[model samples]
Each structure stands twice: as C-alpha cells, then as structure tokens.
Target: MAPPSVLISGAGPTGLILALVLLQNGVSVRIIEKELKHRIGSRGSGVQPRTLELYNILGILPDIQKEGAPIATMAKYNPGEIEPSPSPKLPSGSSPPQTYRTYPNGLSISQERHEEILRDQLQKLSCSVELGSELRSFEQFSDHVVAKIVKTNADGKQVEESTNFHWLVGVDGARSIVHKQLGLSFLGETQEEHIALGDIAVEGVDPRFWHMWHVPPKLLVLRSSSSTSKVFMFAYTGRPEHLAENPPTREEFIEEFYDVTGRRDITFGPATWMSNWRPNLRMVDTMRSGRVFIAGGSPFMSPSRPSLNTHVPDATHCHSPTGGQGLNSSVQDAANLGGKLALVHKGLAPVALLDTYSEERIRVIAHMLKVTTELYHKMFSGAGPADPSAWKRGSDLNMLGVNYCGSLIVFEDAAGAGVSSDAYSRAAGSTVQAAYCAPDASGLVRAGSADAPTTLFAVFHVSMHTMLLFGGDAGAHAPVATVLGRFPEAAVRTVLVIPQGQTAADDGALFSAVLEDQAGHAYAGYGLTAGELAVVVVRPNGVVGAVVSNARGIERYFQKVLV
Candidate 1:
C-alpha cells in the first residue's frame, strides 16, 4: 500500500506554508490553486516575529529579506516623531511609557513577495503546484478523500477531474469551496462592512514607515515585500449599497477615497490590486474531521482591523491592511502548523498530537477577535469607560497570554497546576522574567514557568522494550532520551541521558554511551546531571516525580507522588 497522501487547496501563504510543513514529514502533497499565474493580493502586509522565526527555519529568510524591503520597527506618523502607546491598551488616566521589542525576528514584507518565496520553496519539494485548478467539491471517507477538481480552459470552460487523497486541507480563502462542501459551520457576520482600499507608490524617502493615520478616517500605510511597495487608504463608511448588487469599481473607489481622506492627492498608480471588503470575521467551529482539516480564513478567524483599531495575529500566514497583522498571523499559523506536522511526520510523536492544532488556534484567534473588535469600537465608535478599562486589561502580546483555557485541552501530567505566569512580577527566585518555554524546537510555544533556558525538545513515553537515543548521540549533554521508558508502566518514567562525549550514530552500541544506571540514586531512574543535560519528570503540580540520577533515591520520590 502507498503511504498517505494529502491534497491542499489554495496557495496563499497559509496554505503554502502548511504544505511545506506537511511535506517535511514525508506526506504526499499536491497544492491546487485557481490562479494559473502568481498574483499578489494587497492583503497581509506585516510578518510578525514568530512568522519570521518560521522563515528562518525554512532557510529562506535571507532570500526573502534580500527580495523584500526592510520595515521600520516603530508605528510612526510621517513628519511626526512617533511615540509608542503603552500598548494597544493603556491606563485610562496617563500615557504609559513607550517601548518596542523590534520583535527580535519580526518583519514587514509585502504579501506578494512572501508568497513568491514560499512558491520557490514549494517548487523544491516533491509536490508541485497545480495552477488553474479549483476544488469543485470533495467527499470524505474513513481513510481518504475523493475530490472533484475543475480545470479551467483557454475558452474559460470548466472540465471536471477526479482524484483521491489520503488527507485534505482547505487553506482556501473565506469563500472556500471546500468549506461550503464540508457542511462546517462558519459562524459569524457576513455583510459588506466598509469601503476604502488603494495601492499607492511614494518617492524619494526614508526607509522605515510601518503605517500612518491622520485622524478619524484617514488611515494610510506604507508596506513592502519582494521588491514591491504598497500604500493603502481606508474610510469608516457603511458598505456601498451598490456592492450588494455588483462589485465596487475604480470609479466608485475614487469617490470613497476622496470622501474619506478629504484629499485628491492620492490617485491610483497602476492599480496592482483593489478590494471592497467587510470587516466581518468568521471561523469554522471545528478544524478537522477524520482525514480532512481546514486552515487560513476558512477554519480559523479573528476580527479584521478597520482602521488601526484591532488585534490580529502577526502576518506570517495572513495579514489584513487594517492593523497590518493579517500576514503576520497567517504566517505564524503556517509556521505553527508546520512545526506540529513536522514532528508528527517524524513518528517521534503520536498522531494524537495533531489535535492540538485546532485547540490552540481557536483560543488565539478568538481572543484576537474579541480584543481587536473592542479596539475598533472604542477607537472608531465611542469608547465607553467600561469598555476601555476592560480592554486595557489585556494589551501585551505575551507568549503565555493566549492559553488553552478551553475544554478539549487536558494537561499532560507534567503540566503544573493553576500556576498563572501573570501573577508573579518575579520568578520563584524573585527575579523579573520574560518568555515561556515550549516543548520541542518546532516553536509551537506553550505556557511554561519563568524558568530560564528551559530545555526545548520532546519527551517520548516509550515502551519498556524500546532502546533510546538522544541527538543521535548517547552520553552527550542530555544524552539519554527516556530515563523512565524502562520503568514499570505505573512508575514515573524519567529519561535524561547526555553523553559525556558520545553519540548513538557514532557508536556501535548506542545505550552504553550515556545509559543511566540510576537504580542506586535518590531519583533511582530519574534522569539528571549535577551540571549537565537532564530530564526530570514531575507531577502536574510541580512536585518532582522522577529524575535521572539523584542522591536521595527514586523509591521515595514515587511514593511521594504516586500513591
């Protein structure tokens, strides 16, 4: 039998990034897009820090950075020295101090340029893109999906083609054909909400202009990616009544632009792109069912930015022109989904691990929608005192801020109980801290303590009959993989072995290089090192349950936590 194959629809950054991630796991992928050619939509101009990290992983940032222009680190108005707000939300009375992180690895590249890079990467993979192809519909079964695709002809005629897929993902946009066919609920408002969009070119200038707004309705932005520069303008008016019957035209757009900006200096250059869109945000109630999954705007959603008044995930996967977060968020989504699928592909992790994708995304996007929607209402619509105060409560983009505070989320026995990272201004040692730790190097962050330099990798619960290896070497730092893999099923299993100087690949006998003889220590079989790589298993409440090699002994440790 052949290995599982997947059909990914849509070549937007989100779908493209997702395809790259899944392919890393040796899954068969075929990306089908309706466009026979590459087109850069003006949406999703900002790539967030997390998304940049993803590009770094793909080994394509140097190329992206080379092809794209650099973005200013600050949100500044032209001819004005930009002062940072405490955050999107600040204290009511006084101005909070201005601060910026430069996102360490964040960037602002045009949506088109980002897509170009992704397309290049996709070409390198075994799976190639199918242009002029549209997903007419699909049928899901226990093992695979049978999809009907439409092939457009030179005469604009459509012909139907049939194909089978082991798994399918709908990374298609909001008007997803797959979304409609799946009967998945895209619960949210759907109406033409606002009218105002444009692409402009500016000359003879300084480099760093992230975005700018005059006051009230006049919002303009300068963003770049892949050798292209774009400027957009927006207005706070009801959807064009005519759009309901027909698409908005350039003549109509000219009027809306003039009315909102109160100026005619802005004229459409070559009109690279244009759109009349509503600010409605919708998401699928579920991301997956059987062998199918949904991504991008089709499955996950958040409130769209209307003028600089909303929170959106950074621009890795998708970015809207509003807060410039659409692309960043989309890219991050791709990166995150990429990491999870990558690990799953390696078989180093379980299939159940894929379940976390929807769980984490729902929380992140929902909070973004709630907070950003409120920001729009306050900044554009009048801000009631209560609204501003409530919104102020959550302004920082802490990695730990978006928690899996939902139901399907269950603690991994190692998760500490109820320890909110926000409560402490200081760590257990009383030092100010920042950042959370995530399991595995995929960069799919999880809520961890203020622990510094936390070990970042996966811990496998292997069967007692298994032989373990770490970093391809045993006895190296953190050389042992599972100190507990060999323990009786009920006992705490902790494997922390780092070869003092040996690797499994280099040695004929892998276990001897850094195998733990912890049967004598307090941790008994707990994996540890006085000043070396270690793996220690603890109870969900943060009590030490097992370690590699401790002095006290392992028997009492299990007695304390296990029964």
Candidate 2:
C-alpha cells in the first residue's frame, strides 16, 4: 500500500516543522496558509532548547541561534536587579524540566522571527507555504481525505475550491475553520478576567535592560529580544471593563501602559501589533476529529507570565515577559508527532497508537495552562504577588528530554533480543537511532576479539522478522559458517556487526569478509562470543531458516526455509 500524502494547514513553526519531517521521511505534504500577507510585528519572544534540537533535526537551528541574540545577552529579571539569564542547558540522565537551561539563556525574537526560521527550514526541504488559502471543510473516507478550500484573488475576491489528500492535519490553529467545519468541539475557558497587549517602541530605557516594575494594580514587564529599541510591554488589570474600544487605540495604550509603569518620560509609538489578549485556559477534548489535529495557541490557551501555577518556576508570574516555554512546547509537539507517523508508515505500530497523540499532548499542555494561568493571576491580579522582581539563577538545568514510558512503537535492539532497560535487563536496551551512527575514535575503541554467538533466537515472523548475533570471536566460528553455506538457497545475509572488547578496526565487517574470522563454521552455528559483548543484525527472511546457537543443526535450518 502507498503511504498517505498529508495536507497541512498553517505555516507557523509547528506546521512548517511537520512538513519538513514528513518530507525527510519520504512522505508527501502540502501546506496552506490563510494569511494573504506577512506580519512585521513580533509575538512570542522565547524559544527553548528542545525546540532547538527539533530544529537541529530539521537542520536549521544553528543559523537561527547565530542570527538571533544570545540568551545570555537577553535580559532576565527576578527582583532588585536585572541581568541576562543564561541559555537553557540540560542535565543528562533526567526527566525533569528544571534540568533544562534556556539557550542564549532565553531569546526575545517575536513570533515573526521564529516563523522566518521555520520558513527557511521548509525551503530546504523544497517546500513552500501556500498563502491566502483557508481550509473551510474537510471530509475523511476510508482510503482518502478531502478538504474544502477558499482562496482569494489579487483583487480580494474569494473563490472556493477543494483539495484531495491522503491525510489532512489541521494545524490551522485554535480558531481553525477546519475544526469548526468538522463539528469538533474546542472546549476551554475564555478568560474570566483581564489581560492587555501592547506592541510599540518605548523611549527612555536602555536597549539591553529588561524592566519589571513591581507596581500594584498592574504589572509592567518590558524586554527587547530583537532590536534594542523595540520594547514589548504588557498590562494585566482586573478592571478591563473600564478600558476602551473593540479595536484598541494608540492613545489609550500609551495611557494604560505608561500609567502601569508610572513613567511619563517613557513614550510608545508606531504600534506594530496591538490587541487585547485575554487569558484563556482551554483545550479540545479531541485534537483529532477524523483527520485534523489542533495546534498552537488557538484551541488551547495561554496565561500571562509571572503568575501562580505557571509552568515557569519563578514568582515573577511570567507577567512581564516570558521567553522560554511556550515556543518549546509547540516544537516538542511536532517532534513527537513526526516520530509516531514514521512508525505508522512502517505498519510497525498499532492502529490505536494514533489516538494517544492527543492523549499525551493534553498531559503536557495541561501543565502549560496551569503554570501560565497561576503565573498570570499572581503577577497581574494585584493581590496575587507582593513583588514583581526579576531573578536569574544557575538553573538546575533539567532537560525535558521526552521518553516513551509507554509508547507502543518500541522495537527490538541489535542483539535481536529482549534487551531490558533500567539496568536490570543485563543487556543494553536498543538505541533509539543507530544507522546514522558513525564510529567515534573515543577511548573505548574495542580492539580485542570477543566471541560472537553463531545462531540468534527467532520465531518465524509470519510476515517479516529481524535477528542479530552479538559479536563473538570470528575465528571461533569457521565450522559454523561452513555448515550454513551448505545451504546456498537461504540468502542468509549478515548485515551489521557489533564488536565487544577491543577488536580490530571496527567497521561492521562480516565473518566471511574478515580474514581472522572462522569462515566455515558460520553454517554450523559454532560462532564465538565476544568476551560476551556486541551484537550484529541479520536481514529478515534469510535463505537459511532456523540457525540457533544452542542446538539447531545446519541441515535442519535449511529444511525450514524450503518448506
């Protein structure tokens, strides 16, 4: 069967990332964006390391980090003084988020800068984002998926069209037209209180300083991640009822923003982006209603920073300026999804595996909501935090390196054995990725020969199966190879060799090819054990049938494959 060709909506970081990963894995994808134009205003100024790693996989993070300001150069505030919080760093061998450190400490590029990085990555994959197209409706059939699209002309006339695809991912965002068209319910809160947003350049402050005023009634958080002059500020008020018009005005913004900071000298002008963003705590009960999934800030919610219960660790309540977690969460979501899709394509995972995409994500997003919500209330709620000081610490640097505690797509490792984990397996668990693995000239280069077992255990895969021979002494198994070669019909090909102790120049050479190896015995199941160490892989469906190290004979093994 042919793999599904995916149609993705939205060109934000998440959508662009999904497109890049799918293309890399031999999957086809098309992206559609509703925006007819691009934004100059920056939003969501923080990016985290995990997100950067995902970009690394996509091959775009390095340039981005260089192009953007260093996290250490970005300002960090907690209390009396302001300083730069170092980039996010991660401690190895841990699952906690606290172990992770912000790279460049924490950056302050608006959403636009982040998107530029994503767009460039997409281009590297030979793909582009189609603009001014909206996914109005989509329907799923047993074998295919289709969507209704509305496109606007040069003169701004709207025209409707339909697109066909093998699958449709609605990264169309929270207010996704696709979500509504699919009759999927997006369940969450429209913030009960008040939140304000202002996008303007303010005077009377150094470009390098991240200012946080511990004011009562409202919190003033200002930081510049892009140009030094472009300062971002926010105000949270319980009395939003006393505020102005449907669409806000610059006059009103200057009044409210400056009043919160109590600085008449500081003036804001040339509003690039100005809108009231309410604090919403929400999530769709299901991210997939048929073939569409909801992502980004739309369906789910975000609370202002420096508040109570915010995923962020400090008490500043994330009110002023948050530079880390939100962007990190979205990038993480895309990485997890891509890996799962690869398993599905291989038919190595259970069908039910698909649903958990939403199940697990909800767990993470739920945490973000709680953390941000609490942080928002605490910082801006007036009665919440007594002081809005900025603080930076030598972080615990816990990397939120995600692991599949219960993922269904786990595969057997190199030894073709049930290698256990948690140190109790006595054998190392299979590595998550290996083929791309290149040998390192590290101190542990195994030069001494270890005995490799002749036969590996296997139950005939009704379809296909994998097997591995832990590297053992090649010289010890000549008789075995001879016995196996006795059956030329079983194209028993040896793929990779895992060496144990210090062995010869290790390049995964097979027994037949290497001179020191016992050529004849690979057939007899008389191979050696490498001081009891490394393992080698055997291709599935070998010509030879049952070659067991413990007891099976060469003749018997041949009979099984023929039968």
Candidate number with greatest lDDT:
2
Residue-pair clash count for candidate 1 = 48
TM-score of 2: 0.65
- Can you tell me which runs of candidate 2 are displaced by over 4 Å? 1-4, 72-106, 227-240, 244-247, 298-323, 342-352, 382-401, 410-507, 510-563
Error of 1 at 321 (Å): 5.7
Alpha-carbon TM-score of each model against the true structure: 0.64, 0.65
Global lDDT of each candidate: 0.45, 0.47
lDDT string, candidate 2, 277-381, tens digits: 555555555655555555544312332432211211111011223324555566656655654454454445444556756765665555555555555555555
Tell me how far the alpha carbon of residue 397 in candidate 1 is from the true structure, in angstroms, after superposition. 3.9
